[model samples]
Target: MINDGLTDSKFDQRDGIPDAQKMSRAPTVAIIDIGSNSIKLLVARSSPNNSGIEVLYTHTIETRISSGISQAHPRLSAQAIEAGTRTVTELLRLARAYQPDAVRIVATSAVRDARNGQEFTELIETQTHYRVDILDGPEEARLIARGLATDPELSTLNDYLQIDLGGGSLEVILLQKAQIQQAISLQLGAVRLSEQFLLDREAPIDQNTASAIQTHVRKTLETSIDGSLPSLPVVATGGAIVITRAILAAEDGLTIENRSACMTMQEISQLRQRIGGVPLHDRLAIPALPPARADILPTALLTIEAVLEVANADQLTHSFHNLRYGIAAELLEKR
Candidate 1:
């Protein structure tokens, strides 16, 4: 069984490696991740001769699954189902062109929470010839941990806490020397929080509103986890937080390579405050700020801030590599 409570997976690999582990060359693989806020495709080729995997291509679309999630029930709206299926169909077509040895599609929180999620996945499979694997909470956490572990520098920590902030949920995993000690997925997502408390209002939410959001997040984390966050190296991933790192780098006039550099809470908070004041329309003009992310950025940052308090770390390092990277690595090992 996997950490996210999944017993098994029906995924298949491309034709390069043998069960005996005697392979001359690594296989080329593709993964399509249907996330809450976005759909991403990552194509990579691994070489047994070489220790690293080469990323052939990556693409993403802001499908915004949260928008389609019916607040009243665990169902996706008609529009959402259409958009999600369409995106996956297009991605499948593209992945086929690459002729990867194997291609797999996985859906996360948005799909897992939807009452009609199975219907949506079935539609995509019928239309695109791809099975959609829905990752439960613990499974998602474990895969992320495996992916982040790809970084040699990060894998060496005496203790490491990975907090992946997705559009529909937050997966927090605590690792002791690269082994998972505890993991949990929380429903504290930017899209959900914005819909619940911050939207239908003007830009630059007042401190009062921020306080309420913070209180809600903090109390929720405390209740979910057994105790305070362990003192350890803190790492963050997911689209919004990763992009925020790049945005911060741009604001500081730093080079592109340094965008993923470590950042303190103050820097995060300052960026949050800066964007909070700018209306969505004006935010589009800001460099490195994606138009799709402008409205939800404030709440996204707020969630990170609250998570940082639990981490109790002075700074947070955002990994550009996400779950897709981890999934690929796991497949390579099986090969």
Candidate 2:
């Protein structure tokens, strides 16, 4: 099992009171995550004793703001900027419904990597009247690790690996004995890889192209990952992994809620093969697979499988908590 770093004593000492008694004292907060592929909103409140978080609402909109992000002079297109701004406005409106004590809007790899990223953020700020905090890779990884700590199921884990694959970047965090040893971010995201390697996303990917993508991922990991990773359980989060788990669970005639969190390397490889062999349309027809992810899922799986190989991990446990959760947790702490 993976270690989450949070211990029972830590929780006990956080507030030293019953959660029920502290409920009214907790603060509600909203976090909007603007990513490469989508924009998401999360509204949550701290537990009465401030030892936990209670999710109030969540929503996602596919804006694909990172379109053409792999270009030589990467910039957000006019259409992408407009769509992203509209989505952010909509999500912000939804978040305001809860009258949160604080609201944080953050942008990730896509906005940070794009040459015209600041333009997009400026437009959002101009229209939405909210400051957008652009998170660097390390900060993003740190928040993701903090978010994973909120999961009670993983609270006992003291050492493990965490990987969060987004549309524009991949975040890898290594922790031993509850301390982070390394946090690395790479430009190995599914959308980036797809735009760079897969020229014909609408058609079935050829064997050569598939191999090429895998090779690129492996080579990137080989060079980017500094040293040999310890033999520890891997916990994966992010849209790609969540969608992969949903698709796999649906294939087995099980609901996402009832499916096992543990996914073997073989399962990931098999799914990649099955999805890659089909065209985008066929992948879209698969139950539980998001339409927005249909075109990039194959590449996402390739990257995920590569990560497992590099880590020498046989399986990974999926976590629902991620960056947004971490942001909310921090907001509550400040209150």
Candidate 3:
């Protein structure tokens, strides 16, 4: 059992890796990530050895399809169902247009949490001849860990904790010697939590709301982690953390790599508070943050803060890589 409580833990910034000068070619791989908040399709060309996949094209559709699907008596709303179907159709069309050698589609937290998850999978297979693999949280965390290790930005870090916060789930993986030791996926996510708790904020981040979210996340992670909350270097991924990092960079006049840069707890707390106070319209105006994210960012911030607290990390590193690259890497290795 990995420790999930926030500790004043720290990790080294292991940047300055020599670029791959040989420019090895990448294979063409297509992947569709059915997340709770959105569906993304990525088509990339990669190297023969599965070392890299150069992104060729991408498509994203904000479905909110998994909204409210994690509650005690949850069901996929009609709107969510239609939106998912349409999103998959669009992605399949794009895949056909790209004519890639193989297309791999994986549904993350949202679909996995939905009672009608298989129904959605069947729909995809029937309509697009594509089988959607619903990855368990631990597998999701493992693949994300692999992708992070491959990133040249953090090339020197030997022991690291990687966190990927998605719409329907949050995946945490502990890595040592560039290998994964423990991985778990908690049932807390931006969109899922937002639909349930943060869709409408009745007040600011007082002790009450913060305590509530913290307790809920702590309990959920405790269950997922078993018993122990180990101390390790921390790395973070997913849209919320990425956006939070970007916003921090913009405000602090700091220039760090989008996903590989380190972030201070002060910064994380500040962002969480600032976003929680801002009106939805103003949040939408934030550059790089889409309108789709405005509603859920508050919950996202809370979730991040909770995870950071449980992990006992005073600072964290953020990354743009997630299910898309994970799927690509898995396919390349399998091939």
- 1 or 2: which has the higher TM-score? 2
Q: Write the per-residue lDDT of candidate 2 for residues 1-335, one digit (tens) a residue.
A: 21111212122234456666544545678889999988999989887566789999999898788878788778998999999999998987787666566778899999999898899888887876677889999999999999999988899998999999999999999988878899999999989999999888999988899889889988887888778888899999989998889988999999987999999999999998999899898888899888988999899998999889888999999998999999989877877
Candidate 1: where are CA atoms >4 Å away?
1-25, 47-52, 68-72, 199-202
> In model 3, how many backbone clashes occur?
23
Best by TM-score, which number? 2
TM-scores for every predicted model: 0.89, 0.91, 0.83
Rank ordering of all candidates by lDDT, starting from the highest? 2, 1, 3
- Candidate 3 per-residue lDDT, tens place, 268-315, comes to 787777777777766777766668877777788787777778888888
In terms of lDDT, the poorest run of 10 residues in model 2 is: 2-11
| Candidate 1 per-residue C-alpha lDDT over 9-77 given as tens digits, one digit per residue, 9 for 90 to 100 | 222234334555523335667888999889999877774455656778889988886673427576788
Kindly report which residue stretches of model 3 are placed more than 4 angstroms away from their true locations once superposed. Answer: 1-26, 48-50, 195-199, 202-205, 226-228, 252-260
TM-score of 3: 0.83
| Model 2 whole-model lDDT (C-alpha atoms) | 0.86
Candidate lDDT values, in order: 0.78, 0.86, 0.71
For residue 221, model 2's alpha carbon misses the true position, in angstroms, by 1.4
